[model samples]
Target: MRRGCPVVAEPLDTQSLDAAGPAPPISEADRSPARAPFDDLASDWRLRHLLDVDTLSRDEILRILSTANAMAEVLERPVARTPALRGVTVFNLFYEASTRTRSSFELAGKILGADVINVSGSGSSVEKGESLVETLNTLAAVGADAVVMRHPASGAPWLAARTIGGHIINAGDGQHAHPTQALLDAYILLREFGDLGGRRIVIVGDILHSRVARSNIWSLTKLGAEVTVVAPRPLLPVSMTAGAAEKEHPLSLPNVRVESDLDEAIVGADAVMALRIQGERLSGKLLPSSAEYARRYQLTAERVAQAAPHAIVMHPGPMNEGVEIAVDVAHSPESRIEAQVSAGLAVRMAVLFLLIRGGA
Candidate 1:
């Protein structure tokens, strides 16, 4: 884990398993056209904070997707380094633990030649009675250009954004949102099917507490994908109607459907995204047992076969192998779990590039 200056007091021992290491050198073949597909959107994107996908416009979403596509091309080169954010400093201030997201952001910043720092609540002033606002202000005071943060509290990123002047990238904040994860998932699907318009995507497993599902619903719907969320009644939100008066419920976006029958949801689907059960966040009343959950909602090879012949499988990962997805299905040729991870790197790189340099 890369350490940064402590928030207020002494630094804590915040070593992470997903530390960013040295990237390979960029080769001549890695160079591509300098122009970005979403240059217009980039210029128009005045917001310095990336709080959620629900607030992003279709053109803005496409701009990030196009920028990610460009970054993917760079990754294929011998040297993947870019000086897009060479002098910028980025900090990962995670109040909650994450393997894929934290590592992805750290690596993205490093590959773009930015100074990346990792600060965790466990070993920082946050553990010593400091407030979130205080820590964010301290980071800004120390010259941070951007802050990628994850917190167990919902809307924590939004709160931080209101307190700080630097760019705020929400890694994950409770069940409210995981915007970048959604963008990368869309990137993978777009690469697979070329177009998302009119395609069906089934998101299975725990829905009530999944930040990934919330973000995916917003982004995928904007891209014109037909989204169906399948889960046991306990795991599904109480309401699925868009623009509901309740603010705490899961979003009811247009073109989205809620189903309890996992089998019924997968039929004719172009892609299936199996979300983890999120056992840690559960209240113990929503589920019976892991065995039962697996029997009812697990994405087995047989269930996958019920979908379109060319349908693909997806999982945001740290997969609860047998609980929500069968092991064979997760490792199947149609599975895009690994591809999502790769896409995350490029997507995050694009996000940092756009926020720091303002465009390609």
Candidate 2:
């Protein structure tokens, strides 16, 4: 049975344990065997579910990234497969349509030797009036080791975790959190810059509706990166600008700056991420016009030139070409959009391996 408690142990005090004499000789059973790089990353891993980036500590985040570094090596091999999760089963329970995330998770699990199942809201029993909890319970009844879910409603993964015993990985939940996306984004950034401390990252486009923006704010800020989020006033979440008078919002965090001007925000940035406009999630007309938004906030080649010389360009995907980002900039030499996909695969592989097989 999976234990909810983390495996971390307190450091032993040999000086106090046997102060009168030398400590007892080390026991063979207590000695950890020599292991491959990052094999022990999850030796003390505690999380049973990865629902959001906000809950992950700096150490936990580092562990996942460090492990992903090892997984990247596995991906580089001729076969690009591993027996890490040889007998494990991972179910992708996506309630919303997905291309990058669903495919990435499926590939990650399969690459790790896990039995992966793909389920969609339209094709599943949900069409037959099955509930979210009911669907998760059904998966658990059939020996599902983990459920990576994406739903339109917020907090669906948390609900699934509470309803089932299997590990829960949130793919995305209605402008809530996409932990893996943030992880891969962070991984890509770390790979490029080595350290995020004092680095400037500007996120452009819809902030209120973009779950990627919310999660990125948490992940990047925790890593010591200064983040500036640019969006139209209506597209910006109230939580971010509520305390504008004080220049700090309780939910939005102090490290995050809300900017109305795209040109101003891009200056001196180490990386710039453009978010897809989430029209489906918008309740009403949030922008005056697409052209107006593009004129004001769209990431352009000239604007990118204003950032640091070595700055990288990024997007979470399903990019709106000429709408949110210019075509040339998306394919520019400084763009890490394609690299983010590769990093995502490695990061997901690490997450699946650590959750299901680590410390087993």
Candidate 3:
């Protein structure tokens, strides 16, 4: 058993992909087992800013995963504490509301022995009409080593990265990306399946406005997983399909497919991720009604039965209970939603550690 929870399955006997393939082996010196809790994948490959997964190399994603594995071990211990980032300081600058992302980042920094300061838009100078760049510059002036930010505007983190000297990590930015959430999600799936190659993952629901969906597409594809995004015509982005190639916007990626039918997309899939309908972000009428949306796209038990028997269920939460997923299915054993929350701590820890140390 791991951390008093039943061990999901036995460890895979086969070698990891990098070890089996022609890819260069990660050196022992890069592992840093003595100095840190996890195995660092590469020595020269440093990550300075984490604005989006769209630019992350396969090796960089693997490094974060491997380090997260070690951090998971620390989480399972009696007392989870590490001095990996003892002298570093992190600032959490959130212009939007959050619970899991905010708390986990703060906890991760604390566990790693970093001084973490949280400044939300409500009480901060942002309320006094201070510009984002001005607030970020002020934070940087106070010796912040890194800034984990969530803003209501797309490309906010990218703007901050270009403007600030400190490393910028995107917690979530408008409809652009939430890279670490995608990392933890991939981590959960990696633990369950050992490898993501050839796996079919069905992402169902509001794809048009979900930053989680955007980030997941980039990371999951990079890791060799086939993704099928399912949503109603209005809820799905126009750039998400092959037909959009002729248009200016291009959201489609290799190994990804867009489907309008939820049941068709879930059929024989390895995993099903149901996204919450973000009503707040919706500009105009996108769906007929909440009941209609639930009837068409919700992950009912019957819909889950259509997937592979071992297929997992996921949601990047603040779930709208009976809307995107059946309440029972959300609490079912096949659901990895809860585990994803626990994995967030480790994943965020690995991210902070890598960006602070390796990025240096």
Best by lDDT: 3
On residues 1-360, what C-alpha lDDT tens digit does candidate 3 reach at each position?
Answer: 242111122122322532332223334553464564332432454778898888898767776766666566566658877667878899999999999999999999998889999999998799999999999999989999999999999999989998988989999999889999998888788777768889999999888889999999999998889998888878777666546632222464778887888888898999999998876534457887778888989999999999998999999998988989999999998998888888888878878888887785
lDDT of 1 by residue, 97-117 (tens): 889999999999998789999
True-vs-predicted CA distance for residue 99, candidate 3, Å: 0.2
* Better structure of 2 and 3 per lDDT: 3
TM-score top scorer: 3
Per-residue error for 274 in candidate 1, Å, reads 0.5
Compose the digit string of candidate 2's lDDT tens values, residues 54-104: 999876776777667667666766777766677789999998899999999
Worst 10 residues of 1 by lDDT: 2-11
In Å, residue 42's CA in model 2 sits off its true spot by 2.4
The segments of candidate 2 whose C-alpha lies over 4 angstroms from its true place after superposition are: 1-39, 246-252, 279-284
